[model samples]
Target chain A: MTSPVVEVSHLRKTYPAAKRGGTPKTAVADVSFQVARGEIFGILGPNGAGKTTTVECLAGLRRSDGGTVRVLGQDPQADPLLIREHVGVQLQEAALHDKITVAEALDVFGSFYSERADPAELLDLLDLTAHRHQQFGKLSGGQKQRLSIALALVGKPQVAILDELTTGLDPAARRATWELVERVRDSGVTVLLVTHFMDEAERLCDRLVVIDGGRVVAEGTPSALIEGLEGDRGVRLRFADDGARERATQLLAALAERDADVTAAVPIGDEIEVTGTRKVLFAVVQELAAADVVPDDVRTLERTLEDVFVQVTGREYRVEENEEVAA
Target chain B: MTAVETTGPVRVNHEGLRFRAFWTLFGTELRVWLREPTGVFFALIFPSLLLLGLGLAVPDFSKPMADAPPPWNEAPGITSYLPTIIALAVGTISLTTMPVQFATFREKGILKRLSTTPMPPQNLIGVHMVINVLALIVSAGAAVVGGMVVLGVPFAADPLVVLLVLVLSTTAMFSLGLLVAARAEKGQTASGLGMLIYFPSLMFSGVWVPLSVMPDWMQEIGLYLPLGAAAQGLTMGWFGNEGFPLAQVLVLAVWTLVLFPLGVKLFRWT
Candidate 1:
């Protein structure tokens, strides 16, 4: 890839003690990632997983305790102003003035940069044209989110950092935001998305890093990560009769004993479940055909990103909420 | 999907962009402040209204003072309170309007949000200061005009001295208010702290009792505080032929020099 647009190495950040003599809290332990130009790169983690801190370091809003961050070929710590000029950010809890109208917010923010996107075009793209004159306080949650997104894009930034962009949005709105992000990427801006939603990452991110406890657990495309969990795929088989079920079980057990690809064959009530690698279905059907014993039906279990997370982290994926204190 | 063409990044002159951002932000913030009628009323109109009301309604208000000195004896009773009302106007905006707005913006993350952009969030403080100072001038002007037109009060004997004192006193009061706005985490706390300072300063400014009638010790202490110094200096320049109250001017100058840098140091942008 042509030189990466963003690069971070061993980023570590710790918030100072809230009170005197109190122990400092570590927000980011060690994180490293890169985003190429024109790609949707995701930083996926649970609440308080240092996702915000990592992105804040990239935006030059926060300085890292230890490590290096380079955006658009400049060190963020040394040249924060230049970094801010080129990168657009939509912070999670940041809000506009209550009395500021949609158009006014866009207009004021747009004026901050030298090259800016057309405010009218941005408003139309985010579906906020009808509410352009509406006060920020009067808009619904989704509308506010869309307006924030519009503001982020108003500067025609080369990179956009969106934190929890669709957290409070409805299903339809969430889908719409995903499409908007994709469109933004297609138009040539790199996007760095921070989210805990597996589906959102799977749908939008061309590549992503799964961070837990301030460490990267996995990094790859959604499908590639899921495909990494080999030997977990299985097939459930039903038979025409009890005799056929017994024969199939014995045959699958023999195959499991001899074939390296077959992990186990277990019987569930009147059916048999054959567990093995991705080719388990073909292996089982071949074994059954050789014996001339056919099953009534067959079903394959599908592996999703959720299962991938559980396997990789060795813990159930549960959204630990309210842990972040807005650092 | 409709194709939204992306524009290429262009190199911008930082100084030029910051200059533009400051002016744009000033205009936008001023509009937001104006939309809140309570702030505008207290800062701009209330001072003159209070002056007119007291001048017309109080018994023997416009009648010449029956005190001991020539210039003092010639002026009306209401004229003695003119400086106090002007000081109160500055206090209203400095303590109540400005701090509350700053704290509310911090609480709402408006300042924090601005930090992410190329525009420095400190510009908000400068913008607010300009707006509040302008309001101060307008209110001070109205009170002086209203006093002369409706109450038959005489104009300041030393116009240049009055102007200088107004500048010093406004800066002093605003600096004090800036100290309160610096670290207040909540709007309620800011207003509370502002009021705590506000009422006592009003007392020292002789809002409740004319400084001439206040006890010697009280008057001594009043001259040291910003509003009190402002009131005493303004009164001397307005009715008296004295060049200026050097002591009161020194006091205000000291307050401004000390409080402004301290406020900026303690400021919490987030």
Candidate 2:
């Protein structure tokens, strides 16, 4: 196999405890992942899952206490200036100078690179040409996010690390940003995106590493991760009348009790859902036929990445930074 | 021009990146500073206003003092205010403006943002220092010209000594400001602390009450202070009395050497 564009091995970082005599929190412990060339790889995790810490290590903003991280075949920490030339970044909490105009920001940031992209083209791509002269503080949240993205791309970097890329954007703006990420990937710039949104990771990432408690619980393409979960794909059956519903429920309960196929069977209103191995489907049809209660629709339910995430981490998957509608 | 390659990492030749980065940052710093009403009022306009207003309006400022003692001779009050004007200009830039902006930029994550790029945070500091030095020089020139042209105050008796005093005094005051900015965790706190030192230093530096007319004990105490030493040194140079003010130069030097290092050590990029 070819070496990845970015690789991290056995990364460990511990933040000192805030209070006296308290044990220091291990922010990242033995976490490892890789990003291939031209792919939009994701690091999906909840708050305090070391997503930012891991990205910081990759960006050379933080020095890991243990393990090695290489970016483009070179150590980011040992030779950060070299890596910096090839790595563009849009930090989660950073803002440009309040009085700096959008055009001026792009112009200045572009000048920092030897291989600069056309600021005008970037402005047009991000839909920021109308606000070229607008001061950064005067721009709306969505506009600010777009301007940061423009600044990040002006260097024409080989890899762009966008942390919490669409955290504060509205649904429409979030979708637009996602499309922009896709376009960036298409243009051959590898992306390492850190996010907490389940739908976002499922939609944008070619492959992602789901981190929890500073460890990688699962890593794969979104569909593969969901399919790889050790459980039956969900099965649902709906019946018209109360009698049919009860009969369906009883049949599913018997199947679950037998433990030959179904793991758990539960009734919801006039419907029954049986969760078990793949063989549970055949078993459920046989039971229903035996009961002679085929007066409803039956279908296999597809599991979402959120469900897989919950299964792997043993915790409810929730986005820490709530999305707000831009005014 | 290198062809735009749509492949793996492009090898960039950074021949003039350093100079371009510094020059661009300096220009931006100057541009942003012009937008600051508070900074403009203090660093550029305030000193000239003091010299022009007091020199033209207050007849007593240019007149010789009454109640002359045996050893002490009467001098026009405008001469005394000169040192204070210079000190205030330096103090306002170093103490009031520098710390407030540095801490605010740090709080707003501007410094951290630059850190991720080829530009380091220290470049911001370097840019600010160079810009402020140029600004203070212009404001200082305005003060001198306004004092001489409007009030008819005599030119410096020893121009070189006056220049030395201004340089050393600015270094001392700015280093103190640097220390405040380095230590304060937030913008407001830095501003508050800077103002605390600024007001007291301004008063003792002869902004409000002339050091010449202050009570003996108070004058003695004020002479040892940074602004106090500065006012005395400049006044002595302009008047050509007490050759070189060796003590004043020593105080300013000691403060610069000590405070500048401490400021650098305590500075936090985040």
Best by DockQ: 2
Candidate 1, superposed: residue stretches over 4 Å from native: A234-302, B1-11, B14-16, B68-75, B241-243
lDDT, candidate 1, B39-100, per-residue tens: 88999999899889989999778789887367667677898888889999989999999899
Q: Pick the candidate with the highest TM-score.
A: 2
- Where in model 2 is the C-alpha error above 4 Å? A235-265, A269-272, A279-302, A318-327, B1-15, B56-59, B62-76
Scored against the true structure, residue B210 in model 2 reaches a CA lDDT of 79
Candidate 2 structure quality by residue, lDDT tens digits, A1-327: 456888998899887866799877788887899888889999998877888889888888888899899888778877677677789999887567788899888878887777789988999989999999999989988889999988889988889999898888899999999999999899888999999887999999999999888889899999898878786677888878888888788778977998666898898766788888888888888888987889479889977788888898787887662222110
- CA lDDT of A256 in candidate 2? 92
| Best-matching candidate per lDDT | 1
The positional error of residue A94 in candidate 2, measured at the CA in angstroms, is 2.8
lDDT of 1 at A6: 85
Error of 1 at A144 (Å): 1.1
